[model samples]
Target: MQLTDDRLIRADTDTVWRAILDPEVLKACIPGCENLTGSPEAGYEAVVAQKIGPVSARFAGVVSLSDLRPGEGLTLSGEGKGGAAGFAKGSAQVSFAAEGDATRLTYTVDANVGGKIAQLGSRLIDSFAKKLADQFFERFQAAVEGPGEAAEEELAEVDGDATAEKKGWFKRLVGG
Candidate 1:
């Protein structure tokens, strides 16, 4: 299956790029994502729990970013195995650009599934994937912008007051 979409985030291009590359931000945004380890430069490992149709499983995967241009674009490829539930593998091409004070992020993704997930049929898988993508972007936007501009200030303060604590907790949880 393939999917494409774009989002207009209310933040500068640099801020949006940095946040998207941050594992902590992705962990918080992606539904059922248990953790994300590693970095953009070294590839990333992800553990995600998901339920599709009647099957539920935990997927462990590795993702790598290629064709990278800092604060610009990258192509991400990954594959995940979910024991008896089957497997999924996909790649996404993401591009970023500035739009006034905000950022425009455009993405194109191609993926395939096998086992029980594929057994559920194409329509279901397509809808589920679309829903998950929507949820991810929504949460990502919130994480980057916060609750209006006030929340951004609060985050900056938090980053200052508990810099080590915050980073440590995130690193510990993600095992990075």
Candidate 2:
């Protein structure tokens, strides 16, 4: 499957870039994500429980980011095994541009699935993928917006903490 889209984030490009790289934010945004570990340098490992049509499975995989251009863009790629449910692999090229106080994020993805997942109707898989992507971006946008003032203040307090720990995948996805 192929997917392409863009979103406007109500935050500076640098802030949005940080949020995207934060594992905690990713974990929070990914649908049904159970765990996410590792750093950007080593790639992230994750276990996610997902249901597509009549198939429900726990997928374990490694997600990596490369071709980074600082606060501009990067490439994301990953492959996961869903046991009997199937397997999936995909890659996306992402770009970011400054737009006033907001940041514009654009992405183009190419994905493939095999085993039972491939046997399932394409419509089902397409819809599911679209839904998951939409959820991820929506959550990301909210996170970049800083949500409430208290949250923004907290982020500010830790802005230069340098000692901050790597967040979980959930945090990275949901921007928590």
Candidate 3:
């Protein structure tokens, strides 16, 4: 599946970039994510748990960042397996720009899945993906801007892919 989105962040691009690259910030924003270890140059390992449809499982995976342009953007890719549930792998290109005093973050994700997850229809998967993205971005924005600063107004242009892929993996682990 493919997904894209952009959101206006209240912080400056530099601040947003630094926050986005912070493992602690990411772990907090990702739903069901238990831990995230490593660095931008070395790569990261993650563990997450959730129930997708009727299946529940924990996924352990590795993510790498490449083609980095510093505070501008980079490519993020990773894959994970969930025993009998299934497996998922995908990548995303994320970029940032100055939007007045705020930052405009945009992302595009291209991903594929196999195992029982492939059996689920695209519509179901798409809706689930959207929900996951919305939740993650909402939380992420709040974290970056500070709690209570994440009013509905700032979420106006939000969009993109990584969170949905995480959601897909959760679904994949459960079954299609």
Candidate 4:
């Protein structure tokens, strides 16, 4: 399957680029993400719970960023396994253009699936992938431009606030 789209974010290219690479920002934006970890040299590892029509599964994957040109473009590639559900692998070339204080991000993705997911029909898979990508970009735009520079500082300050909050609640229940 193939998917493509572009969005304009009301932020500088540098800011947009930083948010795109920030693990916390991505985790907050990605739908059903259970975990996301980034490596300076090795890209990122993600665990995502996805539901397509009547099927639901957890997918673990590694996404690598390559051919990077700061504030310009890069290629994102990843493969995920969903056990009995299926497997998916794809690559997307993402390009950014400066538009005054805003940035325009354009992306084109080519993906392939095998197993149960492959058998589910192309229309379903295409629609699902489009929806997922749309949701990701929407959340990402909100995170980057919502609260101005203060939000950016806050994002940096509390990298794993979500996980920490969960841990805190668990500790309270255990009377730690």
* Index of the highest-lDDT prediction: 2
Tens-digit lDDT track for model 3 on 58-176? 87888788898888988878777877878767777889999888889888877665677656767766666566666777777767764342323243325332232122221232231
Give the number of colliding residue pairs in candidate 1.
0
TM-score per candidate = 0.80, 0.81, 0.79, 0.79
For TM-score, the strongest prediction is 2
Stretches > 4 Å off in candidate 4:
147-176
Clashing pairs in 4: none
Alpha-carbon lDDT of model 4: 0.77
Evaluate residue 104 in candidate 1 and report its C-alpha lDDT on the 0 to 100 scale.
94
Better of 1 and 4 by lDDT: 1
Instruction: Give the per-residue lDDT digits (tens) of candidate 2, residues 15-119.
Output: 778877888777887778899999988899999888888899899998898998889999878789999989978777889999997789998877777899888
Give residue 15's error in model 1 in angstroms: 0.7
In candidate 4, what are the lDDT values of residues 1-176, reduced to their tens digit? Answer: 78889988776787777766767776887778899898635889999898887778899998788898888988877788999999878888889999987899998988787888888899999888888778877787777665445555575468855322221121232332
> Per-residue CA lDDT of candidate 1, range 1-176, in tens?
78899988777777776776787887887778898899888988999899998889999999777898888988878789999999988777888999998889898888788998899999998888777777877787777654545554576687785233222232333332
